[model samples]
Target: MPQESSHRVVLMVDENSNPFEMSCAIEVFGLPRPELGRDLYDFRLCAAEPRTRMRDGFFTLSDVADLGAAEEADTLIVPNRPDTDAPRAPHVLDAVRRAHARGARLVGFCSGAFTLAEAGLLHGRPAACHWMWADSFRARFPGVRLDQDVLFVDDGDILTASGSASALDLSLHVVRRDHGAEIANHVSRRLVFAAHRDGGQRQFVERPVPHIRDESLAPVLTWAQERLGEPLTVADLAARARVSQATLHRRFRAQLGTTPLAWLTGERVNLARRFIERGEKRLDVVAARSGLGTAANLRARLRQETGLSPSAYRRRFGPSGGEPVTP
Candidate 1:
C-alpha cells in the first residue's frame, strides 16, 4: 500500500456546488471503513464562507470549513459547480492554486474542471468534463486537451471526472491508487457499485435516452465481453454484429467513443485485473486467458494501461490470503 497519512481531503464548495457530488466525495473519503481497521482519509467540507447556501438555494450548507481548509488539504476536490462560464470567486481560485502549488492533488468533478482550467492547472494537460460542456470548455480554455470520451482523466496530481456518477469512479480510482484495488473494491461493495465500469461516458452520451431495446452494438459488445478469452478482432466483431467492418468501426466510435481494438484491449486489461486480483500468479496463464497472446504482451499492456507490472499489481491488490494490516 502507498504511505498512509492522516491526509485531509478538502471538498471545496460554493453557492453553485452540487450537493450530490459532494455527498459522493464524502461517502468515498469521509466514511470510516472498519474492515480496513484504519481511517483512510480525513475529509472536510469547505466553502468560500463558513455557512453557504447550495445550488438552487433549496438547501443551505451549515458549519462548513472556510477556504483556509483547502490550503492545508492533501487533496482538494472541487465538486460540480453550477455554471462553467460564470466567474469563480477570487478567493476560491487562489485557494485552489495554493493547494496545487503545495503539492496537493487537485480533483474536479463535472463543471469543476472549469475551475481547474481557470486556475491554469490544466494548461496543456488532458482533462475530462461532461460532454454537454465540451464546446464551452474548449471556448474558455483552448489550451487544455479535453477528452470527452472517458469517464475521467487522471493526469497524475490533476484529475477530472466527466459527470456526477463518474465522480464516484474518480474517487474510487483515487482510493485504488492510494490503498489498493482490494480496499477500493471493498468500498465499492459497501456502496453497491461496480469497482470499475465498462466503456466510458461516450456510450451514455451517444444515446442519452434510455434504450428500451438493445442498440445495434449492444449484443456485439456483450458477445465480445463474454469471449475475451478468445482471439477477437474487428472482423470477428463485425461478423458477429452482421455489419461491414467500416460500418462496425463507425458504430464503435459513435457508441463506445473508441476504436474496436482499443475497446478490446481495455476489456482484456479489465479481465486481467480481475484474474490478478483473484490470485492468478502465473502471468503466462493470465495472458493466455485474457487473449493477450503471451506473458510479455500482458506485461507491456498492463504497464501501458496501469503502469504496474503483473507481479506488482498482484502484490498490491491480489487476495491477501490472510488478514489486512491496520495502519
Candidate 2:
C-alpha cells in the first residue's frame, strides 16, 4: 500500500455543465471508501465564476468556492462544459495554468478539453475529446493533436477523455496510476465498471446496420463481441450481415468513420488491454485470447495503435508485479 496524501481534488463546474459528467468525477473522487485502505481524495465542486445554474434544472446557489480552491488542489478536474465553441473564462484558464505550474494534475472530460485548449495548456499536446466535436476542436486549437478515436489520452500530467462515459475510465486510470491495479480494480468492481479502458479505442464502434435509417446495431455487435477470441475477418462479418463486402465496408465507414479492418483490429486490441490490465503477463495468452493469432502480431498492432509494446503496455496498465518496462 502507498502512503496517504493530504492533497485535495478540486472539480471546476460551470453553468449548464452536464450533471452526469460532473457526477462521474464526484463518484470516482468525492465518495469515501475506507474498505480499500486507500486515502479518499477530498473533492470540492467550485463554480468558475459565481451563481451557476446546472442543466438539470437546478441552481448552484451555494457551496461555491473561489479560484483559491484550485490553487490548493492536488488534482483539478474539468467536466464537460456547456459551450465548447466559446472562449474559456480567463479566470478559469489562469487557475488551471497555475495549478499545473504548481505540479497539480489537470484532467478534462469530453468537451472539457476545450477549456484546457483555450488555456493553451494543450498546445502541442496530444489530447482526446468527444469524437462528435473533433472537427470543431481542431478548428479552434490548431496546435493541439486532437485524437478523436481514442477513449482517452494521458499525456503525463494532463489527461483527457474522448466521450462522456470515458470520464469514468480516465478517473480509474488516475487511481491506478496513483495507487495500483489492485486498488483501481477494487474501485471498478464497486462501481460495476471495467477497471481500465484502452485509450486507443475508436469512439464510435463499427457494426452492421439493417439499413441506412437503422440506428440499432446492438444485436450484431453483441454477436461479434462474443466471438472476439475466434478468427473473425471482414468477409466473415459481411457474410454474417448477409451483405456484400463492398456494402459492409461502405456502411462501416459511413457509420463508424473507419474501415472494417481497422475496427476489428481495435476490438482485438481492446480485448488485449483488458487481459493485460487483469495481470495477464504472458504475451502469448493475451494474443490468443484477443485473436491476434500470434504474439508478434499483437506486439506490432499494439505498438502501432498505442506507441507501446506489449510488455510496456502491460507494465503501465497491468497489476502490481515487476518494474514498468522502458519504452
lDDT of each: 0.83, 0.78
lDDT of 1 by residue, 1-327 (tens): 333448898899987688889989999999876666667898888889767777888788888778888878999996467777788888888989999998999999989999899888999999999888999899989999999878898889999998888889899989878876557767888898866653244615354244674446778887998899998998999999888889888877777667788888877886787778777899999998998989999999988877999988887777776554322
> Could you say which candidate leads in TM-score?
1
Alpha-carbon TM-score of each model against the true structure: 0.79, 0.69
Candidate 1: C-alpha lDDT: 0.83
Q: Number of clashes in model 2?
A: 0
Worst 10-residue lDDT window for candidate 1 reads 199-208
Per-model RMSD to reference: 4.3, 5.7
Q: How far is candidate 2 from the true structure (C-alpha RMSD, Å)?
A: 5.7
Compared with the true structure, model 2 gives a TM-score of 0.69
What candidate 2 gets wrong by more than 4 Å, as runs, is 1-9, 27-42, 48-51, 55-57, 72-74, 83-89, 124-156, 159-215, 321-327
Question: Clashing residue pairs in candidate 2, if any?
Answer: none
